[model samples]
Target: MNTSAFFEKRVGWTKYTMLLVLLVISFILDLIISIPTLTTTPKLGGIRGTSSVQVPSSDRIGMERVEIGIGIGASEGCMWYGKDDRQCRYTLSFQPSSEFLHLPPKQNVTKHFPDGQIMATCHINTALQAMVTTSFIFGPFFAGLLPFTMILLPITVFMSIFSAISLLIASGQVAYHLKYSIPSFELQWGINSILPFVVVFLQLVLSIYIGTLRCMMRKKNPPPPDMTDEVRLEERPRDNTLG
Candidate 1:
């Protein structure tokens, strides 16, 4: 007797599951770092100490717009309340970190402006995140499903690069502070230091998984396509005699 077989194919979970987990981790890390803005001012109260910068408005509801400038010999830090382009009282008169002692050539600071030191940080960060995620999220899906890449490649690359930079900016922000040298210390502790390593590790894991999967996919032979036991039996030839 002879037999033949048939095999079925389906996309598996490893590729998508790993990416989903990574996405969750990345968002968690981002939130951990970003939430600082809401807490640090009150927490440290260094330059912005217990004070806030608000944009004074004629509107009955006056928004909290207070700008605090900190320095010893030169301006070391500044904080502004929620509004942009509006004026407010200084948050603090005291300088908190040793960096104030080393004063830069001309300490000029701005709390607003899309790219102004602070605002730029948020902008750069948003832009960068938009970039990295585009790639991280779509790269494998498109490559695996469509690979007609001229369409997705540029966009993915763009997002990947931007997100990479946003990640960098976040890292940079981690090492800075409205409290001056506090960032220097944070660079050693908390989620800041751990974040970079986590990103790198996840990226590597994603890369290796993608690489291995791609190689496995391209191997061509693919065990001659899964022959099923039922099919094998169906294809078997039978000889009849009364046996």
Candidate 2:
């Protein structure tokens, strides 16, 4: 069988197309996480604190409950009077993590000033940076190119594996710091933290499956049966008929 034909036939276009879809989803999710503008409320919360700032609406001073948004690179937060009401004119500023990705790292929300305003700063780490960079590189640009060029199978596999492992390490670091390092803040984790892992997992699965299929196809196809000797032996039957 023709190598290209066999590849298309055996693997089927549907699965390959699915790979593209998955990569697209992964890239979008990555972008969603990397941008600091959007904040998602987790079903389970993280790093909760109370500030006795005066309520914006009324002179009645009440304890404002603040919760840090759980995120991979950066997070935004909201202040609440109670579970039902939001404090007015609230602003949560996250110190930018790195100029490279422009995402704020794991946040530390503190009230050090006399005004009772929460100052949020990034605790930047290498692992978080790695995750962001990996997503940017492997997400859209490479994903678009991969479907056209089948030669990149091995490279994609290696990159996906590296990305998954690095993300795992980064996630562990974030979890450890949140649990032990910040005792004063109540830690709550939400969908933001888990979404990146989902992306990595999808990439890993796609890369490995496609790579393995390519390898197996190569072994089965076997290089056109080496016709050198057969060509040489094709005799001069025409000469015998003429004689």
Candidate 3:
């Protein structure tokens, strides 16, 4: 099926899939490209973490949480690093230590200094930086762009569709639409129930990463948004048929 018509005809089915593929492709492209900001390490310094924790290898893609520790310095902020070649707000871990530090002690809260969550964030963020930066650099060269729109167009279109589908599936599994249990992941709940929420947030970030690559690839000029919808009837044409 032709591309534009395929979109028009199966728009509903394609909606989520479209988003997914875009994200995957962006992640891939981000991995490929080293344009400018690939060299810097996302400044995740002095992020108080458990001094030592077991980092087990699992089928699960991102870094896994191991232990809990304390919170210290610069309570809340954002940073970007490595080469995810992805976009915006840098890394994606929730600041549990930040919150725990800020919060006053309630009855049963077990607030540990440099806890597992902190350790987990550190590992996940650093690893992700590497993955994303690598992907960004790879994307552009993988589908090299010359003046010839014919080859580029098919590559862009096909990659968009394929990557989007893959992304959707990957993200759906992350999003909890399709349930597959990871035993270790299950154990993380003892530390914090909201850990999965962090996963969803990171997945969304990955989705956005793929989208960035697609935007870089395509060419279009979208019209400005129409802004005259809220005018009152009395504001104009007060007289009947005032031609």
Candidate 4:
């Protein structure tokens, strides 16, 4: 007896799943990092304390106080001397990490501190905005449709490249803003900044690989031609048996 077999053709599913997961990770990280109140640690305070030789209690009065130029913003106050009683005061301020990227640069913030002191500066640049938009919109959209079709593979590759470039530029902008705008506090880059680069690289490499595989698969096993049900039935071989 002889048997007929049909072998179904398919692409690499492991790599495809990896690419989807990578894009999803990028989307999540981007969304989390964009939050306005998100802040990272290792922030250096502006104040520096000095040690003095042991002295009388009376002489130690006001010795611990160090003069630092503190910026004050609107809707906040300094509680230096006392809540009610007041003395010469300065405002200590620190803003969240995301505010450095989202807010407009030209906004007046005044408090009970010296005037003209620069607080946190927030300016969203094109690269940063692009990266954010890609992560929130493009990343998820591409990831969602990737498993179903190969048409978006090439576009995903390009989007990954664009996202990587935008992320690099955004990192530079954030670093610059942190270094110059608010030098008082030293903010360190956490996982939020680092993981996106890795995700982007994986996405780029996986998409390119998958796209190449797709091309190869197409060349190896061309898609079957479209046909009507009647034609398909007519093409089917009829079995004949003799008893």
lDDT of each: 0.37, 0.41, 0.31, 0.35
Alpha-carbon runs more than 4 Å astray in model 3: 1-116, 144-213, 219-243
Better of 1 and 4 by lDDT: 1
Clashes of 3: 38
Model 3 scores a C-alpha lDDT of 0.31
Tell me, by lDDT, which candidate is best: 2
Q: What is the C-alpha RMSD of each candidate to the true structure, in Å?
A: 11.6, 11.0, 19.7, 11.7
lDDT of 1 by residue, 1-243 (tens): 111110012225554566657755654544343333323333221112222333346575765444333311001233323334212223212223223222233332222111112312323333444445555455443333323322333443344344445545433442354324322221222334245345445545654555454456455422322454565678888878769
TM of each candidate vs. truth: 0.37, 0.43, 0.20, 0.42
| lDDT of predicted model 1 | 0.37
Q: Give lDDT tens digits, candidate 2, residues 1-243.
A: 333444466666677567667656655655554444323443322223332222234345653332322233333444443344442222334221122111123323221211211212111222333343344334322322334334443344344445445544544544554344322234445444565556657656756765576556555542343554464467424455655
lDDT score for residue 46 of model 2: 22
Relative to the unseen true structure, what is the C-alpha lDDT of residue 86 in candidate 2, on a scale of 0 to 100? 40
Worst 10 residues of 2 by lDDT: 113-122
When 1 and 2 are scored with lDDT, the better candidate is 2
lDDT of 3 by residue, 48-115 (tens): 22222233336666554333232221112122212221222222222232232222234112222122
List the candidate 1 regions with Cα displacement exceeding 4 Å: 1-16, 27-197, 221-243
lDDT of 3 at 41: 28
